[model samples]
Target: MEKTYLTTDELAKKIKYDCRTIRERLKDSVLIEGVHYFRPFGGRKILYIWEVIEQDMRVSGHGFGIPMANGEVCHG
Candidate 1:
């Protein structure tokens, strides 16, 4: 199946976030490398998997807090 890939600009527009914010804050923190995005041909350009991102966002939290890399959820 052909998946929907979106550029940083395109994704920012769809998600209503600034491209800079996505690149800096959300990139490695929430939007993972292989899971949410990938660089074609091992290049510097990134393309976000719209379907995966959308799906994850729909069920991201449980009224808890930030997800940690160590498999812990911090409630605030």
Candidate 2:
């Protein structure tokens, strides 16, 4: 399958979040490295995998108390 790689700004636009939030907050806290995003060719540019992030976000319930893959929800 062809992978869809999105830049921080593109991901922010798709998810309706600020690029800064994605860069500073979501990068490592929730959207883990390698799984959700990565530095292309080991460079400084970060590219996010839409499928993985979207799946995690959907399962995350957007902080709406929805259950995750591990049967947990965000309480805040």
**What is candidate 1's TM-score against the reference?**
0.78
- How accurate locally, in lDDT, is each candidate? 0.81, 0.75
State each candidate's clash count: 0, 0
Q: Can you write out model 2's per-residue Cα lDDT over 14-68, one digit (the tens) per residue?
A: 8887888677666676778989888978999998999887777678665324224
| Candidates in order: C-alpha RMSD to true structure | 4.2, 5.5
User: Global CA lDDT of candidate 2, please?
Assistant: 0.75
* Candidate 1 structure quality by residue, lDDT tens digits, 1-76: 5799999999989988788867766788778999999999999999999988888877855332454557555655
Q: Report residue 66 deviation for candidate 1 (angstroms).
A: 9.4
What is model 2's C-alpha RMSD?
A: 5.5
